[model samples]
Target: MMAPDVARVESAIEQAARRGDFDNLPGAGKPLDLPAAHDPDWWINQRLASGEIDSQALLPVVVLLRKEFERREETLAALPDERAVREYAEDFTQRVHQDRRANPFQRMLAPAWDPEDAVARWREVREPRPAPTAAPTPEPVAESRRRRWWPLRRRG
Candidate 1:
């Protein structure tokens, strides 16, 4: 009763499972937690994970702009000198402006990405992310339900 495509996909998955492809794989038994709605960045994340897609080649000018800025920031961080950093910052700003001008959606362009803030953005990207701190301890368990945040007046 299975559709051809579905059966083929199931067979492939079963074959992979039999070949030990699932053995010791991280989160093997866990459910897939997908986003509730379609996510724009999810496609790019999947492309990057596969190693087959060149980030630079991916489309939609805004996405390219974001990725380009990130790449530029990484390159600048490694060899940042005042002159080089200043030049790249200026060039990056110019490129962002060009992208905005070329974008078909004039509304999406207006005040969407302020190229003027590129230098500040660059500084943020170059900064290392702070380490994850331990989670704050939960509040002590209350002895009675009546003492909870909202005191309930239970009529006897």
Candidate 2:
């Protein structure tokens, strides 16, 4: 037996349907727009696409750290000097260690990043790029050899 509230809701829905409240509605007879392949994170993707959730916050801490490691050059390039880069690398390494300690189960996923190695990488990325060689100047053409086209005049 249905509860009184459920019975009342069904009756209300039936009354609305009879009154044509469900007719002429948007996509009433159209097939659902489903993905070609099933996606487990469809709702999360929709929320991300609709700007309802911050993509950065949605990533796992380990994943974030890995991304930071991958983009270390870009991060280091923004620093003012070697000292700042060193500090940042140290801080990043400390955070990695702390995360490993806090989540021992995730230790396998969060590889330890060496601060010294990060400093070396920063130096390599900071190296100045060689100046581009100047293009060879073209020899000037003789005035007599240069052709000039005259605009056509209307004969009419």
Candidate 3:
């Protein structure tokens, strides 16, 4: 009942086996190393573990938003000025609002970031710490009277 192409392939494989083409190959006669509990997303997990793909790519929009919220400091710090930070916060808030509106039934919704709060936080993080008190100036050291060493003869 096999298709002609399949039967031909099977026959060719059999001939190759008989000819010892697959003998002594790597992992011959060994059982495959499979996990005891099958994971449906094993390939995805493998890629994530090996960093072949970005982890954020597989995250839900809400989760991604939450992660962004958590790292807002770093993101805002990279911006050149307060205006850029304010714009970023506004954009982030808008996206959160949009996502909430679009996915009303989603179980885990990311809380909307307050643009004012974000700006405040950015300012707080950007504020320069009070300059440390200047250390007491060290007393001037007396010049040493030791003669200098040199190989050149005095031309006097």
Candidate 4:
């Protein structure tokens, strides 16, 4: 699958923040010792001034921040867990099998999802896959052939 778009993620985080989604995140309603500065660039500059190095360059740091924000938004979005994911897969599969549109957006999302093959991907994650065998089994023991051949060819 294609890597998530950094810009899109950042934009989504900003949109969510504007809509108060972050404040509602799980474990986030409690008072936070959030940074005094609200502006991210200002926060970065402050960290720099304090001799705290952001090892990742600005773009990457922004992306990381965006992902954290997205996680918070997702948590607040009250999305389902593995069971829900499994249920969704089963439902979607049934819909497809029945030649129905499970969701209109699925058509748009399907192309990006197709190349990676979700069932195999989920199996890889869920199952303990066995390591590949190196070679076939060796031949088993022979009967009296080895002993007789050795006696016949004994050094005289």
Best by lDDT: 3
Kindly list the per-residue Cα lDDT of model 4 for residues 43-94, writing each as its tens digit.
5676676678754554433344344433533332343345544554455445
For model 1, the stretches where C-alpha displacement exceeds 4 angstroms are 1-56, 70-73, 104-156
Off by over 4 Å in 4: 1-43, 48-82, 86-117, 135-156
lDDT of 1 by residue, 82-148 (tens): 5566676666667767877777565543123343454566567677899999999988776775355
The top-ranked prediction according to TM-score is: 3
Candidate 3 — what's its lDDT?
0.84
Give the Å error, residue 138, model 1.
21
Q: Per-candidate RMSD vs. true structure?
A: 17.9, 14.0, 15.1, 18.9
lDDT leaderboard ranking: 3, 2, 1, 4
Q: How many backbone clashes does candidate 2 have?
A: 0
Task: For candidate 2, give the lDDT.
Answer: 0.82
Candidate 4 whole-model C-alpha lDDT, 0 to 1: 0.51
Q: What is the lDDT of residue 139 in candidate 4?
A: 96
Candidates 2 and 4: which is better by TM-score?
Answer: 2
TM-score for each prediction?
0.34, 0.51, 0.54, 0.21
Query: After TM-score superposition, what is the CA distance of residue 32 in candidate 2 from its true location, in Å?
Result: 16
Evaluated against the true structure, the overall lDDT of model 1 is 0.68
Model 2: per-residue lDDT, tens digit, 4-73?
9999999999999999999999779997556679998776776788798888997778888888888887
- TM-score-better candidate, 1 vs 4: 1
Q: In model 4, what lDDT does residue 11 have?
A: 83
